[model samples]
Target: MIPQIRSRVLWIVMSGLVLLLASVHLMIGGLDQHEEKSQRLRFLPDGHFLRTASLGYRELTADVLWLQAIQVMGERKVSPEAGRWIYRLLDVVTTIDPKFTWAYEAGGIALCTLVVLPEESNRLLEKGMLHNPEEWKFPFLLSINYAFELGEDAKAAEAMALAAQLPGAPSNLGRLAANFFVSAKAPQQAIDLLSDLYEKTSDPGTKSLLGERLKRVAVERDLQLIEGSIARYRQSHGGLPSRLEDLTTSGILEKLPIEPYGGRYEYDPHSGTVRSSEISERMTLSMKRRRDSL
Candidate 1:
């Protein structure tokens, strides 16, 4: 009983000493200093190391990190540094769980749309494609990146073709694949693609919007055909035609092309330019007005 009592007292004394030491340490350093140290230590680690540390809970860890990334973005209010960190966080998440399609999709989009980091977005999207080869979203996003960001029509077509091959992808993607073959310069291809999308979509607002796009594309197509015929007539006759009928009269064109907005094709002999009478002023100047809106 004596030995037991002595042992209990010693244990109590030792516990007190340990706590006393911890208190002294905290007092010496100060909470503010400790917090500053912690802040300094909050740097991101390598994603591969994180994945290795996650063991079998990689997906869960990735999800947590993704949430944290989102919170950081929200907190930072889209500062440039936040944009860079978001990519790093997304990379880590995707590295941990390659099969998480939403991470890749959302990450890629944010990187491109919000961050405007095309190269980083393309890298994330391509990585997603490797992991989810059967997913149409990755390739579709890649196609958008190539077409809009990089201005690579052939690459866009390649990606769109991959997307079209996947199940559940919109059927218009196949037609788009063909248009990409024309370097995305053919108005007919754009018109066909828009028509197909319009046909399959069920939303009224979207259909109405697509109707505008269809009309614009049609006008663009008619302008292209008219311009090509005029160019041919110029090449053959060494001058601009006096009127739209001159092309048909000279056998350069079988007949006058139909105007998209139900108006006659207008010819300006002074400037050797062709325009639709019913086209808006913006459309008459450039087709890029609508494209710029995109």
Candidate 2:
């Protein structure tokens, strides 16, 4: 009985050892296959010549391929299956090289422009920013979308402020922050910021741009003030004035402020309201597109 038990224990131990060897061999084989595949993909047609020239052709090829994939995704009218495939490819590329700024930028642009998902694009930009906090482009893109695309001026102002604080942000970003503040109905703050920027900038081109932006902010603030006064007058009188001159007679406004954009504020007599006549058509279209996509 003791001999039989010893033989059975030896058989079990040998089986276990064989299984462990098989597992290790399989793992090593899989790793070698992966390495071989990576090597083949890393070599281009002129890889030998490029290597002799000391150029990083393999990395450049990866970047070019990333751009091409993003472009195709942007231009194509993709089905769910195609979208999934494209998204997976992008995820793989970004995961392999998290610091590839162009990959992140292209991915964000494609997702926003083609996928029509602002929140998703924002997530991508946020991830990129995590890897590269010094890059101004991600914050700038986020701010522009918040202000113009999302119509959330407060968030836009926050993003613009961050961008302006970054190392290489263009000087014009300060003006963007001011514009965002004005859009959020904080005219005094906007005026203050713009006034400071205009005073500080000495370059002619930058100064001209800042001047135009400040003038626009001033006009928008005046328009809002005039409109509020008109609203109060209507609350008391039960109606708006028939013309701009009527506002003065009705004691609502001392004088009509000329729009800084060189036109009188447009009045809708029937609604007793006024608005900018030359509203940005691009913003209007963007809003419409957003609604349609939703």
**Number of the top TM-score candidate:** 1
- Pairs of residues clashing in candidate 1: none
lDDT of all predictions, in order shown?
0.68, 0.58
Every model: Cα RMSD to truth: 13.6, 16.9
Q: Estimate each model's TM-score.
A: 0.51, 0.43
Candidate 2, TM-score vs. the true structure? 0.43
Lowest summed-lDDT stretch of 10 residues in model 1? 32-41
- What is the per-residue lDDT of model 2 for residues 1-294, given as tens digits with 9 covering 90 to 100? 999999997777656545533443343234334654223222222323322322323354344435435444644364433344344445544554557776656555555444445565577677778888998767866765565446678888888889889996767778768777775545555456557756755644335544655555565577677778778878888887677677788877888787776766877879876776643323213556767889
